[model samples]
Target: MSREYKNVISQIFKYLAISLVFMVFGFFVGQRFIPQEYIYYANRIIAILGVLFVLLAIFSRKRIIPSRFSMNYVYLFTFIDGILMYPLFQYYLYDLGIGLFVSIVLGTAVLFGVLSMVSSRKSGGYYLGLGNILFAGLVGLLVLGLINIFFGGARFNLVISAISLLIFTGYILYDISLIKYSVENRFIKDKNDLSIHVLNLYLDFINILLNLLNIASYLDD
Candidate 1:
C-alpha cells in the first residue's frame, strides 16, 4: 500500500482504539453508578460532542491540509455512536429478538459494503443512477414505518428495519469508498476535509454495526 493508504489505515486503527476506550468507560459508569435518567442525558451529551466533532472537521478542512486530526473526528464519532447505542439497544433487545436484529444489521453492513465498492469503481455513477432513487424510497419507507410504530404495529417496523438495513448498508459502502477515493485523489488535502470524510465514514460504519447488532439482539429474543 501507498503511504497515504497506510496513513489512512493507521488512522482508522487509532480511532477504533480510542472508541473502544470510551465505550468501556461509558459502559462501566452506566452499569456501576449512573442513574437511568442521567445515563440518557449522558448519551445525549456524547451525541452533541459527535455533532461538534463533525462541525470542527468541516471547518478545519477549509484551513489546512489533511492531518491526523482529520482522522480523530472519525474516532470521536464512532465512540459517541457506540455510547448512544448501548442503552438504546439494551432497551429494545428484549422486544426485537436477537436473530432478527442480527439479520438486519448484517444485511445492512453487507449492502453498504457492496455499494461502496461499486461507487468507488463508477465514480459516483451509482449515486446518480441508483443511489438517489434508493434514498428517496428509504425516506418514504421511514415515514410510513414511523406511522406504523406510533399505531402499535410490528409489521411495519420489521419491514422498515429490513429495508433500512439494505439501503443504509449501501450508503455505508458508498460513503466509505468516497472517503478512500478522496484521500487517494488528494481532494482531501486539508485537515478539515480529511476529518469530514473520516467522520462520514465513521458514522456510516457505526450505523451499519448498530443496525446489525440490533437485528442480532432482536433475533435472540
Candidate 2:
C-alpha cells in the first residue's frame, strides 16, 4: 500500500479503537454508577449534548470550526453514544434474557466482521456509489419508525426493525467504501475528514447491532 493509504488506515483504526474505549467507559458508568431515578434525566441531558456535538462536528466539516479539533468532537460524541447505548442494552439484556442477548450480539459482530472484509476488497468501490440510496432508505425508516411509535403494533415495529437492520447493514459497506476511497485519493486532508470517516463507521456498527438486538427481541417475544 502507498504511504498515504497506510497512514490513513492507521489513523482510522487508532481513532476507532479510542472511540470504542470511550463508549465502553460510558456504558459502564451508565450501567453501574448512574441511579435508576436519574437515568431518565441523564439520558435527556446527554442526548441534547449529543446533538450539539453532532452539529459541532458538522460545522467543523463545513469549515465553521478549525479542522484540527474534529478529533475532540468524535471522541465526545462516541462517549455520549455509549451512555445512549446503556438503556437500550439494558432493556434487551433483561427482555431477551442473557442467552438471546449474547447470541444476537455475537451475530451482529460476525456480520460486521464479514462486511468489513468485503468492503476491503477490490469491489469495495461499488458500494461507494450507494450513499444516496442508503440515505434515502434511512430517511424512510425514520418516517416509518415515527409512525410505528404512534400506531403501536408489534408486527409493524418488527418490520421497522428489520428494515433498519438492512439499511444499516448497507451503511456498513457504504461507509467502509467511503473510508477507502478518501484514503486512496488523499481526500482525507484534515482531522475533520478523518473524524467524519471514523464516526460514520462507528455509527454504522452501532446501528446494525441495535437493529439486530431489536429484531431478535421481537422474534423472541
Q: For each candidate, give its TM-score against the true structure.
A: 0.58, 0.79
lDDT of 2 by residue, 1-221 (tens): 45676677678878987987899888887787656555444323323433343344334334565534567787888888787667667767777889988887778778987987687674436696776777667667656755654564667766766776787788778767767787676677876678767776676676667667767767777
Give the least accurate 10-residue stretch of model 2, judged by summed lDDT: 42-51
Q: Point out where model 1 deviates above 4 Å.
A: 1-6, 33-80, 91-130
Residue 51 lDDT, candidate 1, scale 0-100: 35
Candidate 1 displacement at residue 119 in angstroms: 6.7
**Highest lDDT, which number?**
2
Write out the backbone clash pairs for model 2. Answer: none
In the range 91-206, model 1's lDDT, one tens digit per residue, is: 44444657665566567556655665555555432343445655565556545544543452334444545665565556555555555566667765554455555454554555
- Model 1 TM: 0.58
> Whole-model lDDT for model 1 versus the true structure?
0.51
Candidate 2 ranges with C-alpha deviation above 4 Å: 1-3, 32-69
* Prediction 2 TM-score vs. true: 0.79
